[model samples]
Target: MKRIICILSMLLCMAAETVMAARAPVSEATEECLGCHSSIHPGIVEEWQNSRHARITPREALGVTGLARKVSARTVPDYLLPTAVGCAECHTLNAKVHADTFEHNGVSIHLAVSPRDCATCHTEEAVRYSGNLMAHARKNLAANPLYQDLQQQILGRPVRREGKLTFEPPAAETRQSGCFYCHGTRLEVVGMETRDTVLGEMEFPRLSGWPNQGVGRVNTDGSLGSCAACHTRHAFSIEMARKPHTCRECHVGPDVPAYKVYASSKHGNIYAAMNRQWDFSAVPWTVGKDFTAPTCATCHISLVVNTDGQVLARRTHEMSGRLAWRIFGLIYAHPHPMNPDTTRIRNKSGQPLPTDFDGTYAAEYLIDAGEQVRRTETMQAICLGCHSASWVRGHWKRFERTIRETRSDIRAATGIMADIWARGFAKGPDSDDSPFNEAIERTWCDAWLFYANTVRFSAAMAGGGDYSVFADGRYQLSRRIQELNDWLELRNQLFPPTPPIALRGLPEKPYRVQ
Candidate 1:
């Protein structure tokens, strides 16, 4: 009888809890959105239901203090405190600014949610990210004529015309799929289109760059970035953001290869072996306790803590905040840019590049040595969370050495290319022809852009095994330099610079002679 009564009491408590959860406060606007979308976008609804936004209000979230506090806004409006952050909360918050805003069921609804929308609750993160290089990714590539030319050379289709190749400019769709897919697209509300829906035929704003979620996406609201790039939409899950897989979508390509390097690293080995047992959702991610191995987030972004509740590193939305060097090899690896907008930078040659062709830095645009040292110390602090002082020091020493060594290799390749250009074998910037248009020039690009970058990333991540030795690294570097030399030598011997068509006399008739 006692056991039966206990079971009945437990059932009653469970029922009451379920009733309370069902009665959780939801705004009328959100309820209205749910009425249609719950059925129309069941997956979206399901994802939100599992999110923290659906479970807690701004009031409750703001109450959390210390390192565990995710909400950066010191206070929120009383109107927003009573209800969960739902579809309408984000989509309808800043409606006046968004050109894509349209009336749907008598409510102002915006299609694209910008970083500005998320800033309501996550103010600090939004602010920090505004100054991040990622925020200006689109402008950096599209605004620079040199980079634009390189992009065109890579994406443009080439056709053989009169024994010479001519490249046709890539179509808009091709550019969107190639570079803008990762860098970002300039989104605009072109017009409105009426669409048949479950509710009825309704008018919706037609967006130019509809499906892009690039980090630096320009939204109709005039905001610089898309929060959905990392957080994802409807769910906004931290766990998903913290995972290495989230970064792999953009960084796994040959140009970056960050994910591939990480996947093969010693840290990656540990993560692969022990990740199932790790707690990914911890607020202040404890290094040894929460996760045994470092994910991409652990080193770059997350607010990490030691076991004693001491902060190892503060969280940052500026992804390059802890980075001293920009290892992507804009010709050669240089210090990180001082400002997020690199368009203003002019090298010695008046080109909008951080470094000149000869590897001289546009020093005014790059961070000073003091700033680099500070950033390096910040990164070292994160390393100290799991590694000893000597180990960290040694690792940095090796990384610095690798940077010097790789730059030397790039210089050698650049010298050969310079000689080729001087010899009139390949057209260069001076000739007003794209340096990246010809095969040998593209091969030169591979030396710096692909192989050097791969080796540098390997050294930085301590993933140097096959990556450093064989796979598009030292081995490829040696082979490509040799190939460049061989090409120059062969061209000198067999094929001299082609004379102008007018300079060469017309071919004689083939039928001459019997």
Candidate 2:
């Protein structure tokens, strides 16, 4: 037993020495970050070691073929050409811009790397993403009154107090962990806190709404988005980003239901059955060879190449680049927006459309006709990969027709609700009344937000049987409209209309004239 114990101690000592060696600085000016971090954050160190960043030195990457060349060519300051992309290689650049930068153990380091930091290397992606709705997700969600009203309704706890229904605002923990988990949370430097470390007392900036990878996360450095939301960290594998599950993180819920529709579709079945055999790591992904079925990335983001190595389409960071229509069905189906700044953009009626009405689509604003045609053609090209031109055109035609019909249904429901408000059965729609407090308002919201979105998503993806027919589709839409009309009728009966003041003053004369 004593001999075994002695052997274990020696092994531990060797392991510690190995970690220390790995942490040793490459140059005198650089910090020995790996040494401490390897001991503290072993998992991070292991992932980094396994990453292409560790394996491919800048010099080696320069000689590589395909996408690697594009990535390596963007590395600034030619001195980094011979070294591996270590912690310092990334953290050291643009140190002045980072708000969290501080002196730590004889070296200056930033706690978080912002999109601006990533822009130094990924110039094109950064620019394109800045114009994406996701970049403004946090601001839009937090700032918009209509969205806040909905948030209060959905997340807030409901209770009846003194014959009135009251909604309590959701707690900070709930907001941070729930909706903000996807929409994004504003990271703030709360102050400084002192910690008792092994060496001595050390001060560090206390932060809130951190350790998040939401697409629109407001970084401490004033950057608007988090690249790690999709690319992930350390490894940042192209394979992982190309998978459908990465998008499923936030797009799976009832409000969006994109993942659910895709997962149960014919395309999804093909992917499930055959994706294991596909070459996900290929640079210019061949459509037929690399994948028999399309993942979310294939149709939305990836560059497609033919079996003969001919480029069919280019990769895009903007997921909506090929999308012409915003079919998520908020108020109504409309054209996709030209830019992410939804607040500044106004509708034809001159109203500021709420940002990310549900999840990154607004029915109010639309792109111009030329751009819309270009995007529609781009999307149709993907359909042409496996389907005929007629099938594609027919599918889109059906989708547009469905949108028109759904809009009519919604308009009918809206008219019924407006009548209820006009008759004073409940609070006015534009009054200080909460739109979510009563059953009637919720029914109206469901008609548009839930049922309409499902039908449109089903039609757009060509997976209509279940979604459009039975599950939260046309059935739900029709039912909600009926419910709205019934509720109005019942409310009108329960609270009979009062005579107008003008009619009341002339009652005796009116009766005589009649």
When summed lDDT is taken over every stretch of 10 residues in candidate 2, the lowest stretch is 505-514
Model 1 residue 121 lDDT score:
92
The C-alpha local distance difference test score for the whole of candidate 1 amounts to 0.87
Q: Model 2 over residues 1-514: C-alpha lDDT tens digits?
A: 9999999999999998886455423433333777777777889877877666666656665567774254623455677666667777777667786777777786777777777877765677787778788888887778766567678878888888999877788987788888888878888878878999765888777778876788888887788888888888877778888898989999985778888888878888888889899998787788888888888888888888777776666777787898877777656666777667655654333335522222223344568778888998888787777788999899989988887787777777777776766675665334446556687788988988888888888888776597677787889989999999998788767876665322111001100100
| Overall lDDT per candidate, in order of appearance | 0.87, 0.73
Worst 10 residues of 1 by lDDT: 505-514
Which model scores highest in TM-score?
1
Off by over 4 Å in 1: 1-24, 495-514
Residue 350 displacement (Å), model 2: 5.9
Candidate 2 ranges beyond 4 A from true positions: 1-31, 62-75, 197-201, 347-351, 354-365, 496-514
